[model samples]
Target: MTSEAKTVQEYIDSLPDDRKLFVQKLRDVIIENLPKGFQEGMGYGMMGYSVPHSIYPKGYHCKPTDPLPFMGLASQKNSINFYHMGIYANKDLHDWFVSEYPKHSSRKLDMGKSCIRFKKFEEIPFDLIGELVTKVSVENWIETYESAFNKK
Candidate 1:
């Protein structure tokens, strides 16, 4: 659900025992694979990994005051969310994930444009998730974002 917590630790602590463990594991994977220049924080009421202002001073295109979002992990009302902005912006990556996920995961893939929803920890495709996180580097993300922004 929407977290009222102001910090990432606070958000983690707010989860139930089972959910806490699940999120923590997911968080660990994200952190381990995350590229340099991305920092962890709270964004949109979720635990977010973003391109900090020091790296991308323009901040998020939609909200100049906020950091540019890369990924986000949230314990939502119905499921845990893995939000991947990289996949959302790249058609090939998105298509690959959709095709490969089923082969790797036991649970049915439940996803949106950028959100992969896990109803249970067992539904998470940890290895695939790790690979996805590493697929786009910080420099690559900035280039992609700038290209899209220039097109607008």
Candidate 2:
């Protein structure tokens, strides 16, 4: 019932049934671990969740809306992208994560300034990824995201 949904339900509804089931599980995991005050919405042609505008409004550099720094599951033509903007911005963090990937972990990352791409539900480590997404505070994320965004 987030205004962001605005009957985004129909969009979710429009998905193929198996995808719906897959997305619902992913959605539940993200929601369960998403940071406080973050909001859910669509982005990059996929379901995205991000920190609210109250915390990050437009025009940091005179842009229309502040780019949301988010971590969420995305469906892409070739793969599912589990974006982790925070990691891509922090080399140490990313290195530590990649180094510490658990024994059973089955995924590899196509990193972005803040994204980690994957192909399927079975490949993700929900607990670790969620912790990564929610671990940093909004203020911290903005600082990191700002530094990274500014560099771009």
Which one is best on TM-score? 1
Native-referenced Cα lDDT, model 2 = 0.65
Candidate 1 lDDT over residue span 1-152, tens digit each: 67899999999999988789889999999999998889999999999999999999999989999999989999988788999988889999999999999888888889999999999787688889988999998899999889988999
Q: Write the per-residue lDDT of candidate 2 for residues 8-91, one digit (tens) a residue.
A: 465467666656666676677778887777777765456766667787775234454745746656555655567776676778
Query: What are the TM-scores, per candidate, against the unseen true structure?
Result: 0.96, 0.75
The lDDT per prediction is 0.91, 0.65
lDDT at 152, model 1? 90
- lDDT, candidate 1, residue 15? 95
